[model samples]
Structure formats: C-alpha cells, structure tokens
Target: MIAAPVTPAIATLNTGSSSLKFRIFARDSLDLLMSGKVTGIGTDCRMNAKVTGTGAQIAQELPGADQEAALAAVIACIDAHDDDWRIDAFAHRIVHGGATFTAPVIVTPEVMAELQTLCPLAPLHQPYNLAGIAASGRLAPDAQDIACFDTAFHAGHSEVVHSFALPQAMRDAGVRRYGFHGISYEWIARMLAEQRPDLAAGRVVAAHLGNGASLCALRGGRSLDTTMGMSALDGLPMGSRSGALDAGAVTYMMRRFGLDADALDHMLYEDSGLKGLSGLTNDVATLVASDDPRAAFALDCFTYRVAQYVGAMAVAMGGIDAVVFTGGIGENAPGLRGAVLDRIGFLGPVESLVIPANEERMMAIHARELLETRLELMP
Candidate 1:
C-alpha cells in the first residue's frame, strides 16, 4: 500500500516557468482534498481546480501576465471556495538547491539567496521558482513555507561523476554535475526503500522522461549519479532541450549559424532536442505515434540517448540491479520504455517497473513530518 501523509492543511506548491500547480492533503490518511493549477502565466491564464476526494472540478480564467498575478488569481479561487480547510504549511517544489539542501529545508533567507544565484545554472526555472515563493509570502502569509529541491537527490554522486574537465576554479564556482528532477527520484527512492528494499539496497536506475527529462542511478537508496550535469539541459535529449552536447560543438554552432550567445542558449534550452531534430512536436508520445520518419527518428534519438546513459550509469555503479521508469513518458509510454530497455538489454538482466510521478504527494508527506513529528526521529 502507498503510504499517505498526516496533515490538516498541507499543500505542495509546484511552480513551473509558466504555471503553478498545487495539491492539498488532509491529515487523516493524507488524502488529496483539492488540486489545482493556474496555467499560462503571461496571458489568458486558466485554472482547473478539483475537490481532491470527489474529483469535482471548477474551471476559471485567472488574470496574470506573470507569476505574481498568477498567485493572486490562485489565491482568489481558493478564497472563493469557502471550506473548513485552513492551510498550515506550504511545501514548494524548488527546481534547484545548488550545492547544499540535499534534504528539504524550512525556507530561510540564505537558502533562498543561494537558490537565486543558481538561476543562471537553470535560467529558465530558478527565477520563476523563487518568484512563486515570494508570491506565496504575499498571498498565503499564514502558511509555513518549505522548499524541496529538484537537485537534492544527486548530492551523493561521486567526485568523478560530478566533475567537468574544466579547471578547479570553475569547479570551485559550483560548476559540477548537480542533477535535476530530484523530487521525483527522491520519492521513488523512498518508495523502493519502503516496499522493495532488496532493489533499493542494490544499484538501480530511474528514468524520468517527459518534456523535461533525466535519469538517476541509485545504490542503497541514495543517488549514486544522474544524467543531468550542471543544468537540466545536460542530460538525455528532452522534449525541446538539447542533451549532452560537446562544448566545442556549441562554439562551432555559434560560428556557423551566426548564433549569438543568448540565441545559442535559447536553442539549446528551448528549441533543440526533439523539436529541433524532428522539426515537429516535442512530446515523446506524439513522436512515437506519428507516421513521419522524422518523428520516428526523434523517438530513436531520445531512446538511444537514454540507453547510452544507462550504460554509463551502470558503469558508474559497476552494475545495475533494476531499471525503473517515471514521469509522463517513463510511466505511460510503454513502447518508449521498451525501446530504451531493449537497447540496454546487455545491462540486464535488470528488472523494470513503472511508477507514476507523484512529486506533489511526496512534498506533502515531507511537510506532514515537519508539521507533525520528524520521521527520522521516530523508532
């Protein structure tokens, strides 16, 4: 059985670049009381709110051209719905925690500042993440805010797994392999540790594939290594983000394409990967289902890149015991999963499993502990 959280008014706030998602958990059995998202931050912002247990949904168009306006709209909707619920704690899905914050943290000025500086490392994600927090302080002042990092899971990677060929000065500047999508991996790690301790104790690889994708290698339920380096764009080819490109190739692209630094960054961060390669949809499902050769090629690129990293991760751990899948494509696209698994058959006989992505619930459970009693302190 999946473990649930115990909290009266606890909700996880997942702030993306263009949207905000939240799920409220009740203390008794930690069932979802409500879930909602305000999408399209800049204009024509839309919201879909649902009653957690009943699945009753109400849709509304929220006003906003940015994160601040988006938060106000979310707050207005929550307020309009008169309920017995009183929000006690807010857990945020922070995109980056830099070098520290391997574990969840009570939001502090120092932690917030560090996350802000790391924005350049993930220019597309960190500012919006911090913006949502600042907005929370304005919109939900009574709630005790907590931050859970997406990079925390890979904090245990070996020095070699994290190093770049650059000089020590760059490494000293925190330019190392700080992996991404850690909330999902961290949740899966704990799930495995609780329900499948044998595999949890052994070397395992968890692939989180979606619009944003990455893979994590774990041993003894800790992150041994991951595909994403200093940024989310450094891993396997994602929906629109290029993965694992040579530094020299970047310079060459700049020269040949007459690409400015910002344009190059935009291409790598937003326009490359599956979209650039396929010249079509960035979604894995779309590519896998399409009849176009380019779509097939895109699928091949994605799976091939992922499979190649699987071998590298296995090498990092000496061997892999199980290969698990999560995220949109990871859990839903069995064909894609099969393609990746088929390519890495040599790494087997590793077992494979699919677990739905549940980072929000994970954050709720984490906050539930901090609100009730620290689980680590318990017997």
Candidate 2:
C-alpha cells in the first residue's frame, strides 16, 4: 500500500491582539477545508476547529499561550486531523502598509524589514502580524508567506483625502490618513458588486463596527475616503480604543499626569473607548443588556459617532446611495444599527444593508491569485 499524496491548500490567518482566526482552503476550488480560532491569548487560551464537510473537529485549551504558541497549536490541530491538506501559502492580514505596499506581495526578507518599520503605525496589530509570519516561517519553512494589507484597499485616496493639516515635512514623513480595515471593506465592496450592482456603482458608506471600527466611503467599489486616519485609534470608538480624540486633550494629559509614550499608548489603545465610557465590559451585547446609565451613555455615544461618520462618508462621496453594515457588531446588533440608521433618516430613505464580513476568504482569494500569477510567469 502506498500513501496518498497530500493536497495543497492556502492558509489564511487573521491575527488580532488576543485572537488568531484561521481557515484552510483547497487550493484548486478555494473551498473551505478547516476553520478555527485561538481565543484568549496570554490567558486561558482555547482552540476550536472544525473540518469542513465532515464531522472531524478539535476543541482544546492551551494554557498561557501567546501568538506563537497559539499558531503552533493550530498547526498541530491541522496535522492531527490527517486532513491530507498541506498549507502551501500562508496569507497574513497585515494591519498597516504605510505609504507604500498598496497590494499583496510575497513576503521576502526585504519586505519583512520594511514592514517592521511600520510597527509603530499599528502597535497593537502590526507586531503580532509580523510575529505570526516569523512563526510560520519556522514552523513551515517550505510554505510561501503572502502579506495582504488592511490599508491597501484605501490606498487610492486622493491627496485631499489623505492629507492632514500639518507641516510639509511631517506630511511627507507619512503623517497622513491611511485608513484601516480595508480587508473587511474590500470584502464588502466585492459582495456589493456581486449582489447589488446598482449600489456598487454609486456612493456607499460602509461601517465596520467591531472591537476596532471605521467607516469607508465607497464610490464604484473603490475607497474614496474613510473615517480612520493614520492609525486604528481614529474613526469610531471601539471596544477598547479611543476614536477621534482631540490632540489638545492628549497634550493636556501628558502635561497634567506626566504620561509617557507607553502610558499614553496603553490608555488610548487599551483603556479608552467603550470600556472607559461605560465603566463596564467592552462587549456590546453586555452593554446593551446593562441597566447602568454609563452603559447607556456609551452605547449612545457609539451610535451617535457612527451616524455622524456616515454623514461624513456621504459628504466625502458627494452623496449616499446605500449604507452597508459589516464586522461583528455591525452585522449582529440590530438595535444599534437601527439607532444609527434612524439618526441618518434625514438622508431620505437611503438603502440599508447588512453584509457579513469574510476577510479570510478575501485573503484566500488574493493568495490564490498571486499563486496563479507566479505559476504563469514561471518558465
């Protein structure tokens, strides 16, 4: 008896601050083979995976696992299932590409170095993203690593949309708006083009409301403008991120409290936003269920800001044809969505849609396309 040959697959990794969501897709058909996530990293971590089209599943706890450990467990789960699928490419969700790298590219040493320089732009996300890439190289050196940037979809913004009112030197040094969540927005754009061609060609506002939220103005499925600026900490207030804070307040805090860079980073990135506003959990469902006035206020603020930004996005595109809601909170929270849409009712019966985000699939699509292009160019 001879062993069967392993099937090649594309592994898509969306590494977040405390979670790593992944999916394995068949290289030829792009069908999902396995999907899972490692949640609660650095604490009581858990890994759950299900082999698509079958009953094969994995559910286990990884004690005190970090990103690398979590990814190792994911690979172990893949190997344990004997699924006969080998990951030929690792498609990573890179949070920031800065002013360059506007498209997916095969990661090389030079590319990795350039990406490292961008870690400061997305401190909470970029480092972990690159860490996953490094771990994948060690764990599976034969696999090709491809970087799919979250800022790439918005890279075509005009100079007016990308600039900040700053000195020429600072502006030239990359101190300008470079929107995040392009992966989710790109998926939404593609979905709109496929499902609602009428709206796809017109002005659209997409709200990606989750732990990290932002609004993108899409004209003809291309990003015309967005709410996020320079960092994920801008735009709409998120689970634990302060959005659209006044620069004066930051300076005031620094002077009054003697807060250093690290202190400010932690407060703004991890302690502000919904968590700070509510003085309760950052989870929207929990906040919605709470009777606390602070929770109510937090929810109110979130919806109000979302509504305000929708208007801004509409203004950016000159008008609005449709409003798209995506991301975790955007797709699930109806009351919140209603609150936002209700506030924007003055826009006169704007079309409203709730599209489920599938960024993993988008990354897989990019990987497959890049692979095909590489194969075609081979002699």
Candidate 3:
C-alpha cells in the first residue's frame, strides 16, 4: 500500500504597528499547530503562545522588543517545541496592494518595489507588513514568502463603489477606495458559505470591529460596498484613527494649526479616535472599565459610528439579511456589540452572530492555493 504524502508546515504573520501575530498550521489540513503574538513593542515586549490541541503555553520577554526580535523569539519557541517540523512557507497580511495585485503574490524584488508605492496609502500598516516579509526572508531564506493583501478581497468591487469624486486624472492615478480589513471579511464569508448557505447567498453586512475597524456590505459573498474608502482611515472611527473626516477639515487643520502632512497624518492616525475622545487609552477593555465620563462618551461615539455605518452598509446591500460581528472587539465585547445592535434595531429581523476573526487561517489558505498553482506551472 502506498502512503499518503505529508504536507509541510505553513506560517502566517499579521504584523501590526506595535505587535506581531502568527500561527503555524499543518499545510494539508490547515489544522493550527500553535498561535501567539508579541505585543508592546518598544516598551515591555512580551511573547505568548499555546499549542492548539494540547494548550501548551509558552511565554517570553523579547529584550529588544521590535519586529525582528519578536520574530526570532517565535522561531526559537517553535524550534524548541518541535525541531522535526519543517516550515514550508511564510504568508503575510499585507495592508494594501493598490489598484494592481488583485491576488496574493510571491514576494519578488519587483513586487516589493510596486508594493512600496502603496505604503503611503496605508501608512500605518503597509510598511510594517513589508518589513515583516523582509524579516521572514532573512530568517528563513529557503521558505517562500507569500503576501496576501487585505485589499485584494475587495478588488472585485465596481468602479462606482471604489471611486471618489476626484478628477479623471487623479482617478487614473489609482486614487480610489481600496478597502482594508478584507482578510477578516473573507474569512467570515468562507465560514458563512460553509455553515449558513442561506445567509451566504443573501445580502449581508459584516462589521469587523477592532482597534482598526471597518464594515463591509456583501452580496452573494462578494464585497459590494464597504464603509472604508480609499484608505483605512476613511471608515468608522477606530482605537486611535479619526475615520471619515472631510478633506476640507484636513486642509483647514493644516492651515490653522500649521500642521504639515506628517503631523496631520500623525494626528489623524495616532492621536484621534478613542484615545483623543476619551483622553485616555485606546483599548476598549480599558475604556469599558473606566468610570470617566469621557470613556463613556468615547464608547458612545464608537458605537454610534458603527450603527451609522451599519445602516449605510444595509442600504448598499439593498437590504441586509444578516449582520456579522467579527474582529477583536466584535467577538469579545458583547456589550459594545449590543450597544451598536440596539441603535440599529430597526435593521432587524436580520440574523446576527459573532464570528471570531481568523485572518491567519484565511491567509494560510491563500498561501496553499498560490503554492499549489506555482507547483502545477513548474513543469
């Protein structure tokens, strides 16, 4: 009798501004072997992980507390746990792919150049993602680096959905709505297709609520419209991002406060949203726990924006058949979810469920698909 071949291990990395999350999975079955994150980089960076089935936990303090250091810690942990396991490929969650790269691609020098042009579009994220890719390449030279873009899943939206009221020349230059948080949405769509065909076939609104949040309207499992437009900063307010501000308002701030582009970017991307509004931390758990009135106000504004966008997404879908809540806050913050749902109760009779964000698994699936396709073409 012939024995079946064993698929190699695949690793997915989702790099954030101050953290890096990763998971290792069995390539053939996509069964998660272990998952963890390194958080608080630049301060007290700590790494934590647990094996999927056995719940074997691992923790460490990464001295340098940077992406490179965090990655090294992860590798060391994996090696210590299972030296026999071979890491076949490393997949990444790239924030933006611009108007091109509508699918996942293996990272090449030319691909890196094209992706660099898109960094300004997702200033807070794209650079770190590319950096992670580079880090992976250096650490594991033999493993293939596959970039699965957050913008790729929404690439199929109609021009009308992606376009702004910009001039023809600007639109020609790729200035358009390229949604973020797509990997999370794609995971939700896949889960729905497998678990609830009825809802999957109908109009659905998915709210990916986290430190970075967005809402996507889906029709038959494809993005029809999304609250986020052109940039990640254009959707609902997030932990520190000022979402959906008018262009004129930005220019006014530039003129009045003598703020340049960089300063303006910092204010919008780092100083605003929950932190700015609450005069406290951007963490939802912290805000929820606080007795400060500003905390309540911040929570109110976040929920209000979510509810507002939910209505808009519903309109975009013609009608919403189901509403999905996912991402860190969406899955874990039941009170926040209830608050948003309460405000948009009229949109009901719409089924709702909290789906945990699984972008790592989704990226792994993309990596497998791309690798398999490459193998087929190698002949």
Best by TM-score: 2
Candidate 3 has its poorest 10 consecutive residues by lDDT at 1-10
lDDT of 1 by residue, 1-379 (tens): 9545433678788887888898777754677888888888787788889885556777987665578887776667666662666778789988888887888887767778877887888787888888988888778888878898888878877788889988999999988888988889888998998889999999999989888999888888888888888888897998888998989999999999999989998899889999999999797777877899999988888899999999988987889988989999898899989998899897658899987889988888888777666446668
lDDT of 3 by residue, 242-329 (tens): 9999889999999999999899989998999899999998999999999999999999999999999999988888988888999889
lDDT-wise, the better of 2 and 3 is: 2
lDDT of each: 0.84, 0.93, 0.89
Candidate 1 whole-model C-alpha lDDT, 0 to 1:
0.84
Pairing residues by index, what is the TM-score of model 3? 0.93
lDDT of 2 by residue, 141-212 (tens): 999999999999999999999999999999988899999899999999999999999999999999999998
**Deviating ranges (above 4 Å) for candidate 2:** 1-5
What TM-score does each of the candidates earn? 0.93, 0.97, 0.93
Q: Candidates ranked by TM-score, best first? A: 2, 3, 1
Question: Which 10 successive residues of model 1 have the least lDDT summed?
Answer: 2-11
Segments of candidate 3 deviating more than 4 angstroms:
1-7
For every candidate in turn, the CA RMSD to the true structure comes to: 4.1, 1.4, 2.5
Residue-pair clash count for candidate 2: 0
Clashing residue pairs for model 3: 177-230
